[model samples]
Target: MFAEHLSAFLTHPVTATVLLVIGIVGITLELLFFSSGLLAAAGVVGFALYFLGFYLAGFVGFGDLAVFGIGIVLLILELVVPSFGILSVLGAICLFGGVLMAAADPKQAGIMLGIALLVAIIAVAVAVKYFRHRGVWNRFILKEQLTTDKGFTASPDRAFLVGMQGTSITPLRPAGTAEIQGERVDVVTDGGFIPAGRTIVVVMVEGTRVVVREIFEQNS
Candidate 1:
């Protein structure tokens, strides 16, 4: 009698709705807050409970459960490994397929899937807008800039090279090396190509960028 009642309860639409709500809330919180994996753990537990309910109600088989687990694993891998979005796409497909296959009713499954997708979208938007620089995403993106204040320099200051004359060591198809004051300096032409061995004058120096213009001689 107890077993029958339990099965009925697990299979009930109201119970399914409750489980869906719990799962969605758990996942949203997981994404929105950096809780040192506590929120993520709760989300995993909520999803596990959802699958367990379906399994006990005979709505999902072992194969469907395995697929769902694989999907979750792939999603986790997407966070750590950079597959250029292939893992994320595959994970979404697996998750959707598993959920749809586990449903006893197609209409109910569609509704539930749509709700879950909407919730996920909203949660992601909130996280991106408000918590962009604070969460797990920081691990994948570079948020620091190496500046002079940080004791980082791309090249030594070439400000003194401005207005200095030089000879092009190689054809400046916009950029090439030049011998200025006996020092080989990398330089770029002013939107014009200069042939090798041509006399050029440094017109501008901005940080590592040394701009030069070809010099033309006039017969007296």
Candidate 2:
């Protein structure tokens, strides 16, 4: 008795409509606004709930790999093909076919489509956030400089930091990694092995490398 009522409610257009609304809102916040990953997650959950509800009720199969596979192929064609609008036609065909096959029940199908849109929005948001904040550069997400690229600005000479006093955080066995004043650097020595947690002074900064000398004597 309870299970039948649940299925009937799941098939309700109003329930599916509410799910669609959630998906739309999630997508909107993700794409048009700067945000964290939470809003997008909410959107995905909203959609996923709908998909599961419909699939269990025999609406359509979200778990169908063939439908997904066809969609992917269409996506590939859209990227690689060079006709006037053949890619768009193929892509649309694939989408419609996959969607139609998965939608065994009209109400369930609607819910799954709604959720898919929501998932897309969240994916875009994550992609943008990851690319925007990463140290390395990617062309798609990096539209403008969020801030001035302030990092190890490379120089062409060795006399830049020749007199800066520093210490090695890592053992520099003539040629190893080290840090000076919380700034990590690749350094070499005069064939002298220096252990980590020791004091050294920068004698040269040549192109991506720094040369250091151990300091044992201090004015008292």
The prediction achieving the highest lDDT against the true structure is 1
Model 2 quality (TM-score): 0.34
Error of 1 at 26 (Å): 5.0
Model 1 quality (TM-score): 0.61
lDDT of 2 by residue, 108-159 (tens): 6656566656665676567667655541223246465444374534454646
Each model's lDDT comes to 0.76, 0.60
Error of 2 at 77 (Å): 18
Worst 10 residues of 1 by lDDT: 25-34
After superposition, candidate 1 runs with Cα above 4 Å error: 1-6, 21-39, 135-142, 161-220
- The per-prediction CA RMSD against the true structure, in angstroms, equals 5.4, 13.2
Cα lDDT, model 2, residue 125: 64
Worst 10 residues of 2 by lDDT: 131-140
Off by over 4 Å in 2: 62-101, 105-220
lDDT of candidate 1 at residue 28, scale 0 to 100: 50
